[model samples]
Target: MAKEAKKIKKVVLAYSGGLDTSVMIHWLKANYEDCEVIAVTGNVGQEAELVGLEEKALNTGASKLYIEDLQEEFVEDFIFPTLKAGAKYEKDYLLGTSFARPVIGKRLVEIALAEGADAICHGCTGKGNDQVRFELAIKAFAPNMTIIAPWRTWEIKSREDAIAYAEKYEIPLKITRETNYSKDGNLWHLSHEGLDLESPTNEPKYDQILEMGVSPENAPDVATEITLSFEKGIPVALNGEKMASVALVKALNKIGGANGIGIIDIVENRLVGMKSRGVYETPGGTILYFAHQALETLCLDKETQHYKELIGIKFAELVYNGLWFTPLRAALSAFVDETQKTVTGEVKLKLYKGNLTKVSLSSPYSLYSEEFASFDEDDVYDQKDAEGFIQLFGLPITVQALMAQKGEA
Candidate 1:
């Protein structure tokens, strides 16, 4: 820690213009002694959070402020690939925080190199997973640059202490100890952690916590039906209207949020090896995943689909563990892309009270054959053929049963 700090004259920080990051700008200058802070905020569809950010950064003593609109790139490059791979952490999590970290880190490293900064700093905490995600990405892109994680070295202990420091340094912040719930948001999803969520048994105060979207309990009773189109597993249109990748997500977020489509709560195992509770609102992502899976069921054959299901689990872990820039993740993504070649279709879904019910689906590559599957009459299928096929398919089970019978006798 001491060794890296000695030479860090300037740092490009992944700043959010939020409580922690705003505090970090002043804290870095104070602790590093005459060091310049270059603040970089990636606009990955954080919408309102970006308003007036430059003023905040400058007020907090940032030498410069860079706000890049990464909505399209983030959706196309990062979000789509992960969505195509069906990478959901645990059974419920959408890997929102998992994937957003690297995208943000990529820009941070880019700014660091452009500014000729000696190090990259971040506001991620010591205990949480973002530290690993951001730092590992920085190492992947700019290996030689020093990486500084302020949470690990800062003297301020808790949220309360940080608030005190913010007040003392005259850093503008809207958060206090009682109201602070650590949150991360992007185009994909919004996640809430800390505070009452730290306990698995405690029920969340949804009124206080539901910032991104409403819960199903509060949603309107009427069900909303919509159709979504996909091309090679990438969502392309909503309700027959073609949309840009970023626009599609934004549209679904509103429609899904209105119908109370996406809200998840889980006590998940973190990358750093502790169980943590998070409540996530992934309105757009849930719709995309649901629609894409329906398309896959229509287009993908049984063998390829089953194999990809197994791959999805591994994909989820790789994303969650911050291995996005690694060769293994790239290799897995290549396989996922291959499977998605024929996964083009439109899927109809009914969204109501947190439920996304599959109503109908169609695809150009659909393997479903109504004629062959019919019970009444079809030249394409013969009942006699099933005798041979079933016999062969069940051979192993028959043999095992015969062995058991002989032993019993």
Candidate 2:
């Protein structure tokens, strides 16, 4: 007689309660045959979506459902650190989804270990960067555990197929024929893709799909001013009132969203080496990034600031590519933390129709000295000293030019 097939005892799935993940739950159960599926949902910032997720997961064939409230950790640990580094992928992306992955992935791994599951599963497609990010993070945290990427293994290829599969299995899905955009939402941002957005030539209609932020066309004409206070590069207060991390982020999201503060459309380089067009709405993140950057400008020195800019570029790349668990990222974070020591202050910003304009910023550690920087006669800094300073500064360039002249002669 043939040996019996090895059965998967249990699997921890990173469930989003979306169409893809909803379909994945049944698919995993059917394929594995007798496997107990445990669904884990991370609450980064999808406030409304979290309402019925536990019940939905249980209804969709998950033996157990774990919804971890990770909003505070997401903001304090992941979001703030990236903000402090001034990390922006390719100059446009605030990496809202990028930073959220590691935190979620860590939780998934933790739950998988606790449950003693044979494998960890995710609904991310093989074509996307998220699959790479999720799998890499899983490997980093649990090297010995097996990873089950259903999208790569499954016959379901498109959204239509996913919808069909969900329908066949009687799985409940929020998306319908009228609204079919693939969206990823967290406390930091909400991203929209698919349909008209799939074509870069087609302009995104502001009225149709924007959920997190107000459309610029519909935004209030009056500019709204907000004051953000930071201590050692972390946002601690808003408008002179100290609030909790979660509360502050939610407040900023509300204020910035009202003013249409953060909406970015770009074709970004995915980790899978493809250019994907995405429309991101990151109201609170935009406010935080600008305010933190302005505060750093007031506190950090020229050399440190310049170097930090370079670090920001690399840091953004690392986070976007999903290499959050790597040593290079840790080293970069350490450098970023050092640069942020004096990055304490308050920044006032004017929010008007998708623009966050820094009005003024003040820091106790501010390197800007009015007496020295003033154009008018000041007691500090001698004008004559500039002549000697300029001569020394230009010495190498002068020598190089003189050498070239001598050779020409």
Candidate 3:
């Protein structure tokens, strides 16, 4: 530890401009023997959190601050790809915080290489998934870059300890220690943890915890209908109006938020070998997932759709565990891309008090045929063929039953 610490002359930090990171800038300098700290923050649609971030980092003993606008890239490159892959961690999570880490980590590596820094730093604690996500991405990008994870090494034991450190350093803090909830936000979603959420049985105080949008109970009574257009599986238009990827998510956020469309609470299995409760707010993303699924139903064949669902689970696990830069992920993405070739379509949905209903879906590559499926015996199929097909399909089950009957005889 001493040798590595001495070798790290300069470090690029994945600074969030949050309380933990504010403490980190000063802590790194104090502990690392005059290590130059460059704070790198990604503007992944954190809304108000990005305000005065540069000033905060500079004031907190950082040599410089790099704030990258990653909203467009985040949506287009990360979110859309995940959406197209149909990846959902633990069946409920949209992998909001999961995928955001890779992009930030990638940028951190780029900055470190450009600045000729020996190490990269992050405020992520050892217990959480983000630490793994950040570190794995660092290893993938720069195998030899020393990683400084202060939470694992520092004497600070809890948020209270962190607060004390902040006070000692006179680090300006907007984060209140009173609120035990830990929150992470990006263009994709908002995640809340800690506090009363530590207890799985305790119902979340929605009024206090809710931020990105209103709760379902507070949603308006009237339903709002919206139309979305997809081009090769990417959302291109909202309400029939063309918009950029970032613009589309922003628009859906407002629409979905107004209708109380997205809120998921689950006790998910963490990669670090523990179950943790997470309350996620992904208003726009939820709508997109549902709408995208509807489009795939029309475009993808039955076999491809079923197979892709299996891939989705694996994709979610990969993203959650921070393997975004790996070859498997790239290959999976290529497969997802191929499936999306005929996924262009328009979907109409109605949002009412947290309920998103697909009103209609139409695609140029739709495989639905009313004539073939008609109950009145269409020319495309004969009813007798179904009997033979069913018998063939059920042969294994029939044989098992017949063999059991022979044993009884």
Candidate 4:
């Protein structure tokens, strides 16, 4: 008699309710001898996409579905720290998807452990950064848990193949070829890709391509001024109105989107050693980034501000490359947190046609003294004091010249 195959008792999947993940649910059960699948959806602000997720997961063969609301934790723990650090990959890409991955991945491990699942699965493709981000985070949190990457293992090669598989299994999916643009939306931003955007040269059609923000051409002619209040580096209010983090972000998204505030087009280096052109809409994130920067200018000292710039570069790279769980990132966050102790203030900004400009900023910790920086003579500083100060400041140069004169003498 042939030996009996071992059954997969349970598997926890990081489900996005997308076509890939939706199909993955059915495929995992079929291939693993009817394994009990547990679907875990991390709610990092994918508003309506999560509407029928629980029902969809159950219908697709998941024995259980866990829809975790992680928006507040995402904003407070991950997003705000990156914002405070001023971390931007390649100076434009704000690392939106990059920063959100660890939070989701970490939660997946927690759910997997609690459910006593043998393996954890994800819908990330073999070529994407998310694969690395998800896997690295799993290794960091649950090093012993088995990882199942369906895209890398399964027979499915393309989106078309996945769609066919879903159809064959009678699984419900919202994606179609005509409206197909692989999108990842969360509270912080929305990313659009996998259509005309695949080609670097093809110009993205404003009307057809974008979802999260309005086009600059259609933006109102009148400039919109908004005042953002920050306390300890986290955005606390918008235009003097105190609101929840989620609500504030949503409000800013509407205001910023209408004025065409945050649309970024960039060719970024993926973790898989490839460059991909992606267009991102991060309206509220743009407002927060500008506002936070303005507040830092007023609150941070010259040296701390200069050194923090260096830290910002590293912080962006770490987040982009999926090292969010490493000790170095934690240390960097500690330093960033320390810097934010004084980063409490309000920044007035003008938003117009995809531009966010700082109009004014004020903070109690401001070191900018109008009297000291003034061009006119004042009682606080005598004009004659500059002669002695300059003499002392130039002593090294004077010494070098004196040594030359001594040689001639």
In the range 4-52, model 1's lDDT, one tens digit per residue, is: 5578899998989778898999988877866999999999988778889
Candidate 2 lDDT, tens digit per residue, 1-409? 0121144679999999988888888888787767899999999989888888889999889998999999889988888889999999999899988989999999999999999898898989888989888888898989988888878877998999999888887888899965899899998899999988999999998788889878987899999998999999999999999999999999999998998888999999888888899899999988998899888888988999999999999999999999999999999999999988899989999999888898999998999888888899888888899999999999999999999999999
| TM-score list, all predictions | 0.97, 0.96, 0.97, 0.93
Q: Model 3: per-residue lDDT, tens digit, 1-409?
A: 6667788889999988787899988888887887899999888999788898889889999999888988888888899999999999989899999999998898899999999999998999888999999999999989988888889988898998888988987898987777857899987899999978999999988888888888889999889999999999999999889999999898899889888888988999999999899799999999999999999999999999999999999999999999999999999999999999999999999999899998999988899988987888678887878899999999999999999999999
lDDT of 4 by residue, 155-269 (tens): 9999989889988989998988877788899988989888789998988877887777789988999999989999999989988999888889889989989998889888998
lDDT of 1: 0.88
User: In what order do the candidates fall by lDDT, top score first?
Assistant: 3, 2, 4, 1
Evaluate model 2: give its TM-score.
0.96
How accurate locally is residue 259 in candidate 2, as Cα lDDT from 0 to 100?
88
Give the distance in Å from residue 399's predicted Cα in candidate 3 to where it truly belongs: 2.4
Give the backbone clash total of model 3. Answer: 0
Listing every candidate in turn, what is its Cα RMSD in Å to the true structure after a full C-alpha superposition?
Answer: 1.3, 1.8, 1.2, 2.9
The predicted structure with the larger TM-score, 3 or 4, is 3
Question: What global local distance difference test value does model 3 have?
Answer: 0.91
Q: Which residue pairs in candidate 3 have backbone atoms (N, alpha carbon, C) closer than 3 angstroms, thus clashing?
A: none
What stretches of model 1 exceed 4 Å from their correct place? 1-4
The predicted structure with the larger TM-score, 1 or 4, is: 1
Native-to-model Cα distance after best TM-score fit, residue 250 in candidate 3, in Å: 1.0
